[model samples]
Target: MHRTDGTRSLAGLLALWGATRLVLLLAVFKVYVFPGPDVTSDVLVIYQGWYEVLRTGTFPLDDVTWQYPPAAALPILSPALLSFLDYAHAFFVLALVADLAVLALLLGTGTRPGRTVRGARVWVAGVPLLGPTVYARYDVMVTAVAVAALIAGTRRPRLMGALAGFGALLKVWPALLLIGAVRRRAWAAAAVTAGVLTTLFALAMPGAFAFLTFQRDRGTEVESLGALVFHVARHFGWDGQVLLNYGSVEFLGPYVDAVSTGALALTGIAFGWLLLWRMTATRFLPHTLADAAFVAVLMFTTTSRVISPQYMVWLVGLAAVCLCFRRTGMRVPAALVLSASCVTMLEFPLWFSHVVASDPLGVTLLFVRNGLLVLATLVAARRLWRTTVARPRPGTPRGSAGEREGASHADADPQGLPDAADPPGLPDADPRGGPLSGARRGLTSRASRGAG
Candidate 1:
């Protein structure tokens, strides 16, 4: 009966995914026009132009907007694999394939004995919320790699590291997926993979590393958390121009540097907090890896100077990975991210003109979306810290919810489990049929005596 239910659930998930994805494909393919500005222009114009340049055995050295890492060339150039199709059509098809690949990875990991299908559900639902922009950006492909790495988790640390490294090269954000990896092997593997790939790209391509210099003059993007200050200031006669800077709309004028620098400082602080969490955290559940990664990415994303609409995909992917484990504390944060993705779609392709104009409707959308992200980041960080770093009270008894979670998954601990000498409520203890587990037996005995 359980298996039947599971099969039905899986079938339903697949059906929903197919329906939503067909809508996305139709939108991107121009069969059904999506609202707002044409999101496909990035792929049709910019990505295709870069593809032409990358195919000639060199990076886009002259293009200041070419600010991504060297491995970004692979996706830009991937459309050539479908040589029969035009560039934009082929890119959309590949994007859809990447989206399917992510769903498959989630299903493969989220259906195990201790896992849940909520992760697959999150992926199915979250992607469509961002609308067709999810398919137009190469970020979806990078997200696929990141999802695979998180699913690998502690069971396959080296594979996780390698994929994370490669994903970082693709977009630079996937490197945060390693924040919860306690294994030395994972770090070593990531360093080696990144080093080898960096060297190879540097040696083979004429301007493989030139992207480093392209972002030095970037301004605060209109959609970012810090951009709210400028958005309102614009109404009060602030002399700032919202121009297409470094391929995205940004505020370029006085005090823009200050806001951008503040964003960078916030990012630095986020890094500091993550490092402290890693050093102090002791509870290591199977889900901690994904939970920590989700938190880390949220911190960086929320504090970023450029919160592009597609950036929501990274959060959604990581959040889905966290929810795969039934015990993860990231459910609330994941919900917030999903909500933010919906709002992001509204602010972007739906009503982007208002946003760029700093109109009331646009300001409200940015506030709601950025506010959701900020709340999710804080809530996730607190939950992660409480679960892993904060210890129980001095005289607390065993078998508390947090303690049981850690004990049940103690096998996932990178360091060995606690010995008998450890404290009763310490996360590392063996419970051995504690009070909570024996409640049913106690209830049965009382009922039997009453009947007699």
Candidate 2:
């Protein structure tokens, strides 16, 4: 199909998807007044209590278990400014606005030179696929920030860092975006991030550190991938029980502590791997930062003690940004991530009872969802390794040191690597010759004279 036609079609699809998301949210809002098993806990419950605390001119430290960073206070307290609307309605509207903003950014990035509409496609489809939870949580706001930071990374490093730092305060994972940046860009971004974080902490002071204390004792949340080991262990007569702890479903009982510790250790290992990848990898494509960010988030999410459904939004948002870059080579990985998101919704708020009961269906859903995430993580990591670490083919022009510089300037595709062949308008050199045929011929003539 023509590109214009394809763009028009995608626009239509996005419109329909947005409308459906609105409908689903309205339906969810209607039921929020009288929540049941079908309706998961609303963000309003937490926000309302926190809003009241903010109104009293104090942090929500005493009233609510606010485990988020001090920067999170911005979004948490924002709904209070709209006092005309109930807290639930106001937070819902905020989430919707954030969601729309993310969509706009994705669409804008898609239109940029060297980007594709695939990123927009992922955004259009993945958000609603997660159902009303997309608008029912504040993660969408952080996601919007993440999308902005990633899209701005190549052209506006400082801006990207500032946004990422702001996002880090809202939720910690957004800071991971800086790891993919080059030394100078990473430094600029890190400095901006540190400034933002420092300013927020200075304002909040003692209250800002409250979240740190609160988070220190968290248990392994039942929905986390690591918890699956315990879930399966239950079948083998393990006596662990799932219960609400620290505002989440957690496994409690014999060896539960040990299991949670193991999960934390695994997370450390994941971070180490990311650090090693960053230090060792050489080739840096345009989409490399986004791809690395996705992998980092995936590693953190999958290995964490808590894999809240809302966390899936983080992965989906980054994956969409990754897909926008023509050279990211993450199309299938992005699809897998989106598919995992849909299954997350199914497992929660829908078949949660099954999951809670450790029933066959729930186990199967968790297995599938977690498995898809694992596969996406592995695939993305492999692609990243190949693009960054693998040597160019022996006969390929990119194998030459001089050609490597030229190849770096060539247009990259969605696979996150430049084409192996010479770029358009450039002559293809004979493979038997080194980088330049003239240089090879001159060397040959000298050798012939020496032989004579």
Candidate 3:
């Protein structure tokens, strides 16, 4: 698409998304005020109390459980700035600003050279489709940081690292974005991340680490994919119970601990698989880092013992960033990720009672959402593998020793910057070169000469 057309389309999409979010927020806030059984705005209510505590000048208020990292205190406490606007309203406004910031970043990145409008569409469609959960939770703020990091990964390595580190302080997942950086860039980003994290930790001190103690004894949250095993087991006459625990629905009974342990093991396996893929891949495209980061987050989210509805926000945000690349090859997988976000809304506020009751509808919703996630994960992994690992066919004459060596070195660089010659499947920038270059050039010339 032309630059002007793409810009207009993105603007319209953002406008529609913003309107949908506003409508959803108004409806949710009504429920919050009226106190209804059908819809509960627990995040807003919970943060209201947290905000009150923080406003009192006592950090990490002893009366409440604050499980987030110290940097989260910034957003959590930001509502204090508008004490005149009531806690819920103030927090919602802050979240809306963060949401818009992320959208703006996506649009800016999408318009960059070698990028596409697909990423902007993902953000515009995915966020509001997830419903009010996007605004109610603080995950959107962390998402903004993540979007900025991915956009800067190729052009501004240090900035990307700094954002990732600060985002890690807000939530640990942004650190995954660094996985896409080239070796030197990766080192630079990691160093900045470490430095920022260290500074934040030193400033926050004991309170920064407090969440570790609280998280240590947490159980298997009921919404997790692993919790499905227990859900099915309950119907098979196994004795177990689901209840609210650790600020989320959780399973507690026979084999609950075992299931939780198994989930952790799966997470470890996922990490190992990511490491193995990174180490073994033979080629790297410009989209490699974004694709790799998406895979890593998918593995972490899918295998974890907690799959909060808001967690989908993280996935959606990262998936949008991945789509920004022209050759990411994640179109189908990105659609599935968006589909899962829509299902996540259904499983939450709309039919949460069904989930809590383990009704057929709730189970089906969970199944579909989790199934979509699984499919997206598999599809993305396959695309990454094919693009980076699959070798050329036999009898395809390899280039000179130097060119072959250059390809290998380039693959390992992480940045995946294009060389002067056009890549095999891509069109040449210089019209003089026609389309194909290198070995393909000789083949084309010989075929034309033979035809004559």
User: What are the root-mean-square deviations of the candidates from the true structure over C-alphas?
Assistant: 6.5, 7.3, 6.0
TM-score for predicted model 2 compared with the true structure: 0.85
Candidate 2's C-alpha lDDT?
A: 0.74
lDDT ranking, best first? 1, 2, 3
RMSD versus native structure for model 1: 6.5
Given candidate 2, what's the lDDT at residue 296? 87
**What is the C-alpha local distance difference test score of candidate 3?**
0.73
Q: By the lDDT metric, which is better: model 2 or model 3?
A: 2
Overall lDDT per candidate, in order of appearance: 0.86, 0.74, 0.73
lDDT of 2 by residue, 1-452 (tens): 68889768877967876786667667557753322253425565666677667666556676436888777777877887678987777888788888788888887878764467678778877887777777767898999999998888776777888888788888888888887876475467667776877676757555766777778788888788877888888899988788987777888888878878898898899888888887655566667778889988988888888888889999989999998876677888888989999998888767787888777888889899989988988898888776665354566643466545533432122222222222334332332222345554465346435433
Worst 10 residues of 3 by lDDT: 427-436
- Report residue 268 deviation for candidate 2 (angstroms): 1.5
Flag regions of model 3 displaced more than 4 Å.
1-8, 31-40, 55-64, 203-205, 390-404, 407-452
Q: Which candidate is the best by TM-score?
A: 1
Which wins on lDDT, candidate 1 or candidate 2?
A: 1
Clashes of 1: 0
State TM-scores per candidate. Answer: 0.89, 0.85, 0.85
